[model samples]
Target: MEALLLRVVPGLSEEWQGATPDEIERIEQLAGRPLPPFYRWFLSRMGKSMGKLTYPGLDFSASRVLTCYAEKRITPEPRFLFIAYNSDETMPLHVFYDLEAPARADALVTWGDTWGNVLHEGFETLREMLAWGAVLSFRVGKMPQQCEGIITGEPVGFLSRFDSVMSRLGFTQPVPTGPYCRLYERPDAAMVCSSPSAATFKGGQAFTLGGVDEGALRRILGEIATEPSLEVEVDEWMPELG
Candidate 1:
């Protein structure tokens, strides 16, 4: 986890290589309200920066530029969040654009002057941005048609492995009724007996992994026929400049 923090912290592109306690308080003053607990915690852990971490197969990064220490600005994209992280976790500050109505509203809604230089035109307040980056993760969203045995396998690959034993006994995608029918990805398949959460909406088939009972297990497996994988492209935010 610390290693991961090191990777992403650098990508946040914060300006403050070294921050002072007074600087942090000044930001709070500029932002008007107090910082969120989670954000404060993140700051203590990592300073701020445009982060970069290369996993076994994935190379990801994030970066942000500081505009001013005050006022939000509207930009073309909302997810752009008008924020960036430095490559070093020293300072994470809001990205700048000519103040636009939409950008200002989004910056304020998601983080107000924090995204603006309203606090300090430095990365001192990056702790909040880094924290948000940590929690706001996502996966592909093609959705599952059926979740029979809730087996562990890639939905993007060959289907012959799907419930091979059940053969003739099969079912189609279950019609969603209540929240339980909704979708969420598995927490971790590398482990045994893990389950997905129902509260997570329309993400993947992991939510029902162990949700069914022994009897229900058989019933679910019966629904496992198979479907061809149609590759769906995803929009990944490749943070280049911080």
Candidate 2:
């Protein structure tokens, strides 16, 4: 995917729509880490989610972590990741809630508006930090009061590095916040999922949180599924992708 993203140029011709060997190497240099397995597989199925979900306009699954509207190519905004904490589960935390997970008492250190996670709070506190931390700090908005993140990848050692941080904050099992995003200046939210994850979008597209109108949502999703394909440029940026 990084390789594919490298060849992408703003408003370039269609010839630059595919990834080249040189472009891939450049992206690897930029990302530092090689793309993940899922992303690798996702690259094979490029443009699958083309026109599916346009809110975050997520190019691939990983793109939903930030707050940027999706277009035909990567949004100009640099990527950012904010892991939210959930405190209503068992075992190592998995999900990333989009709300503010740290509080006044839970702050590790502050330089004014900088509220850091209390990973130094200790294991139990870490559990609490991930739990009561309002996990939605990753994305700000009025989302479901009780949305849970799906935690896959059994034996998720990815969270081990922060174990000490978790312990310092007095946390146990916490609720998991799944991948989500929000609009620029609204309380609306949009979720990312392979199987038709739908919700009200920034541009007036709306759907119930859950258990409200699945049939209606399904119909809306079906219509959305049929929308025009979202065109993507391999190593180019298009100011007028629309």
Q: Which candidate is the best by lDDT?
A: 1
What tens digits encode model 1's per-residue C-alpha lDDT throughout 49-78?
223312222111111122332333333332
Off by over 4 Å in 1: 1-18, 50-67, 70-242
lDDT of each: 0.29, 0.25
Per-residue CA lDDT of candidate 2, range 134-228, in tens? 22232221332212222122123323322222233333222232212111111233222111111311122111221123343233233333423
- How far out, in Å, is residue 189 in model 2? 18
C-alpha root-mean-square deviation, candidate 2? 20.5
In candidate 2, stretches whose alpha carbon ends up further than 4 angstroms from where it belongs are: 1-25, 47-49, 56-208, 212-242
Positional deviation of residue 149's Cα in model 2 after best superposition, in angstroms? 16
Worst window of 10 by summed lDDT in candidate 1: 185-194
User: What are the per-model C-alpha RMSD values against the true structure?
Assistant: 15.1, 20.5
